[model samples]
Target: MKVRDKVIVVTGAGGGIGRELVFNLLYKGAKVAAIDINSDALEETLKQAGGDGDKVSTHIVNLTDREAVEKLPEQVISCHGTVDGIVNNAGIIHSFVNINDLDYDKIKLVMDINFYGTLYMVKSFIPYLLDRPVGHVTNVSSMGGFLPVPGQSIYGASKAAVKLMTEGLYAELKDTSVNVTVVFPGGVRTDIMKNSKVEGVPSTNDTDKAHDHLLTPKEAAEIIINGMEKDQYRVLAGKDAKMMDKLYRLSPQRAVSIITKQMKKIINK
Candidate 1:
């Protein structure tokens, strides 16, 4: 669906890919309702918008709260008059430790935000989306969602659930006006670790790094929006994600081993 005159709601709009999505959507002439848990970060996103900031509305929302999420469609509709699409992008990874060493509280937190959060947004807005002439739903799953990373097993599981749920929604909504697209992104330059408050890891804002190997948030956001416009079934946002998706399809065991090694290196670092 074309986003030029549409109103799209993007979660995790405080920073990272989510913030980038808000900017891109606005530049594309789309109105956006940006939702995030961090009010300051959301304010920063608006400030960055400058003159076009009026096209964007910021909502300080915790996705895990079902009551809050349910009210989102109405609030967004009040702001933009109608809703056309939603990008469920807010997520966090747990500490770099084996599942055996991880606590239940941490596991639940990851699932609640990554899986249940997306689910809440999906259930809440899909009905409204169906009411529109052309609507879309984009869910951001990680490369770890498809390829297992030893240290991020729970994170992977949560994203895996998102991946499947999105695909299933696509099938279910095939005859409807709402379109569903699931995204798999590899390592991206974002402050997810610090935002997640992962134990044992120092607060290193990875978003500052100009590493060519990692996909920048702006790049990732562009890819995602492009996919949404074309109504793609799934999108691999980065070279690594594309390569790894093929690798996993060709040989799941080898893919798992390869990512396990990479995770070990990150954990040790």
Candidate 2:
């Protein structure tokens, strides 16, 4: 679908790829509703958009709040007259702990935000999107959705749910005007790790080393928009993400083992 002149709602538009996406969409002539829980970060994103004030709107709402998310479609429609697309991008990571030791509350929080948030957005926006000739839903999964990571098991599970859920939507909407795209992004230059809900896990302080080959948020957002325009079913954002996708498809067991070993190396370092 053409992004130019589209009315798009991007959740979690305060940081990382979401922030860049808001700016990029504005540049492409799309009217954007930038939603996030962080008022300060959302203001920063609005400033970065550099557009006429009417072209952009900001909503500070927690995605995990079902009542709030349920009311979003009407608000967006009232603001923009109609909704052409929705990007389910809000997410949170759990503490880097094994399932046995993982905090139940933290896991619940992660699942509610990452998995249920995407579902809520899709559920809330479908009617509005169906009113359009062609609409798109871009749900951001992760490389961990396909590849099992040692410390982020819960995070991976939430993304896995997104993968299946998005694909299910694709199947259900195959003959419809609405399209679905799932994104699998590798490590990116985001503050996710720094702001993640990790309790006792030591931060990966060597940013340079940890993100040696990470893509910048701008680059990742560009890839996402390109994929959305083309209506790709699955878009891998980086070489590592593509490789992981290939490995998982070729041999799930072997891929899991390899990724587990790699995680061991990173954690031990």
TM-score of each: 0.96, 0.95
- In candidate 2, what are the lDDT values of residues 72-131, reduced to their tens digit? 988887888888999888898876678888878888989999999999999999988988
Model 1 clash count equals 0
Q: After superposition, how far is residue 174 of candidate 2 from its true place, in Å?
A: 0.8
Runs in model 1 deviating more than 4 A are: 51-53, 201-211
Q: What is the C-alpha RMSD of each candidate to the true structure, in Å?
A: 1.8, 1.6
What digit string (tens of lDDT, one per residue) describes model 1 on residues 1-269? 99999999999999999999999999898999999999999999999976354589999999999999999999998888899999999999998888999999999999999999999999999889989998999999989888888878999999999999999999999998889999999988888988998767543444333345888899999999999999999999899999999999999999988888876656666
Error (Å) of candidate 2 at residue 39 is 0.9
Q: Which candidate ranks first by lDDT, i.e. highest?
A: 1
